[model samples]
Target chain A: MSQNNLTSVVVGNRASISKPRLGLARKRAIIRFLFILPTLIFLAAMFVFPIIYNMIMSLENYTTISIATGNAPFVGLQNYIQLFQMPLMSQATWNTLEFVIGSILFQVIIGMAMALFFKRDFPFSTFLRTLILLPWLLPLIVTGTIFKWIFDQSHGVLNYILMQLHIIHAPIGWLISPNMALISVIITNIWVGIPFDMVLFHSGLQQIPDELYEASSLDGANRWQQFIHVTIPLLRPVLAIVLMLALIYTLKVFDIIQVMTGGGPANTSQILSTWSYTLSFQDMSFGQGAAVGNIMIVISLFFSYFYLRFTKES
Target chain B: MPRQGLRRSHLTIIGALIVCVMLFPVYWTVTSSLETNTQIFATHPYLITPQFDWQTYRIALQTQLPHLVSSLIIATGTTVLCVLVATPAAYAISHLQFKKVTWLIVALLISQMIPSVSLDNALFIIFNKIGLLNNYFGLMLTDCTFSIPFNILILRAFMQSIPKDILEAAYVDGAGDLRTFIQIILPVSKSVLITAGLFAFLFAWGDFLFSVTMITQNSFQPITVSIYGYISQYSQSWNQMMASAVLASIPAAVLLILSQRYITAGMTSGSVKG
Candidate 1:
């Protein structure tokens, strides 16, 4: 639980160097054990057990009928081998990469801009900040639903606006076209992601001392110069952490893409999540779905290791 | 005077541009929601329509009100469960020096980062086996898996910042650990609790993929799934879908506004990451 993690780190600090008596330390440790044991058990039962069971299930051909008849057969690594053979599975992997990279780059750049804009003492910055939260605070399904409407081929607001502004003479398909569906989903995702990144970066910006800017200015630094020499370096840690977390999150995104496009118009928008769902639930290929899931876990673990190492070094 | 005038003009122009770009989608949603079905499909989307209609809102509300209720129940249930379970665990980790606590927290973090979609097939099997697939408790349990780690991390940061002497004083007064947590820690850490709960509510509410996979019955489906049924590949009920999305987002938006202060602080503290 949250309490144990905090207390453990604090206790691990070892600043109480006077060294308390063994008897007292033992008593405190006992209390700590008693407090945390319940949580560990709960996690083991609900999380660890199911995951381990899932791993086993991945090696076997299990289904509703298999469960009913107790006729499930162990398949070993065939599930993973099937993954590479399936074209859709390979496509899903590629799509996951595209979604993660595209979403993070756009979200971070726009977020950084918004953060800088809001850092100023504007008249309606508070109102703008609240408005920004609208996209993020709304449920992913809701946002996807709204975006689905926006991308509608017929009677879609996007086409309507484009015509009125003379931007495009003909109605452009936003989601229906195989090429445009993924991009439409990406735009909506960027809208949803911008708020979290901006707020974090904005707060990070505030933590940087104004005196640094003043010092830079006195040394003949212009706005761009001050930003390059002062702001970027100062915000690097926050930026790095935010970028890494956002990349990890966007990689696994599911609800929005599914609700909006259903990985449809010929599965152009399918990512790992939807692909996994389709493989296991829809196709009754539980083993393949587990392989996809395992792939996702491995990728995320790789990113987490890199992130932790980077943070430690800094 | 010249420099001031130029600076003012530059800010005004840039600010106006930013506002236009940022508010366009939201503006489009609200405006399109008010338009008639025919007008919504019009090739050129007009910012100001000839007429506004509230019929779509009325229809969506009348037809799918129960689904809205389902969403509220699931969100509230998941948020309450995550906070309750995560709070005690977070408290222990922050204050207790248990063996292998660091590795435990690391495991918690890694568990959170794993995509929920990956678990769908396995979870489906597990739920089907237990006869819990269509139940609210099943949804709540799965949502808790995704929520507890982040909640624990944020709440732990807040609890760790509290002076240890205060806890020792409570101990000196013969206050039990539970008594101290309930009376002292909870009160001081209210903001962090609220922030964590807000995220829990948001995640539970917005999640569509799991809700659709877990609940087969139309009556038990959440608002997200209900709204999803309104759209198709060829043509969608744009007016109704937008109206439903706007309506669904209201509660979450209000929650954010109400806890704006804590939300900001929670973001800052989370990034500090001991």
Candidate 2:
């Protein structure tokens, strides 16, 4: 949307052509700069400054005691070294990988399915499509909390339904079990994510011309073949964006997992974000938490570079 | 025609089932909110409320009203701040030329990738030093880190589409940049502005990271943090917890239904995400 060529047709010219006087135009330019100055300053204070601060904190021996005593002595790489050697950091690293991958793969697949299903001309499909987006709109905290209820060991709706269906003979503690905690959060994330992916994919699906499908069908192509050859190929642009964003956001999964499991059952489910919080607030190891946070940022920046590349390409 | 009608029913059934499965949590939330704690915890918890009880909600309101009000203030503050800062920046980016607009855009995009943990990790120190801890204004300021750029991008996308002729017309009438923006540009871009504002509000309202990290004081916390505390503190209080969840969802559900087109527009805009 920002790259619309038509958007620049006037303004880039108006700044020069509209004003004849150089001094007056210069004055106008100053005023225009003033408009955006606040945002620039705010972003700097909020993100840029804090990001730099995080780097500094990661190197220093900042902690709860540091806040009180104001004696955060500079420690070169001890925080990083100690955190690396800790068992929690290793577990969090693997868990973060699983959480990100598990979420994006499932959500995109399920979301595309939902999107394709809704694209059909069916009774109340439009209404139901909107209804399906409720999870995405609700707060992550709300989603995680209620899901914690639904995934409860004995009283959970999930276990109850599975047991009733004879799929499981006994109740499973979704959040209590360390391995299941990761799986449970992934499942909840997929539910929250499906609507977003579906919405994006649904729009992408809408843009595919009907003639292509009809032509394929006429060329002796089955529905499945048409989907594989035409639909998947054409939806590449949306797919790229959806995948990039899902990866970026899933990497930052904190509130949901924090509320759902708090990386519980002996720290089995701790991801980098939750681990960072645990280190800083729970453990009072602010320096280690900052180090973990820097690691997360590095991971995000790595993906964001690709995201920017893809956005630029398309 | 009858065959087509039959096919539609089959599709409708599928669609309805999907809706039920996807929305079961929301439905269960409302139902569970209206049931007693005993009924909610019992084996084979009533799928539907046997009695439309208001006791839990009454209790929830007693505890959560202040938290809700606090959340409202913070979210509102964030939205207002976001729009105020973003509109001009978006306008400048779209209408005014900078030395390196692409650089600025890239910078903003990269800023989005800075995880909340890093920001909170540092902001805790900064806020603590500056005496902003447990402060409403501090939380609002932190939440703006999210909404500002999101609104800027969304608004810039819309503002860029506003025809040059409109601004040219305002200029021909001898109106200045500020006047033209206030008189011509703003009224024309009202819907997008509203969309931007709505999503900003939702972002701040749904915020848990900043809420939990910044404001630890019990008297001044949002529903998200409060509900999180409730879940662990009173693990058996499913009825009250669900009631609070329902309360937390009221705004999203209301906005989802009432502003369907705006919600759809905002969703596609990639305003808020994972």
Over 4 Å off, model 1: A1-31, A164-166, A312-314, B1-20, B43-46, B49-52, B232-235, B271-274
CA RMSD per model (angstroms): 3.7, 2.3
**Native contacts kept (model 2):** 0.76
DockQ for all models: 0.50, 0.64
DockQ of 2: 0.64
Best by DockQ: 2
| Residue range B16-96, candidate 2, lDDT tens digits | 998998899889888988988788888887887898999889999999999999999999998888888988888888776
Which clashing pairs does model 2 show?
A: none
Model 1 Cα lDDT, one tens digit per residue, B150-224 = 788889888888888788767667565677889999999887898999878877887777788899998998888
Q: Distance from true position, residue A177, model 1, in Å? A: 1.8
Chain A, candidate 2, TM-score of 0.95
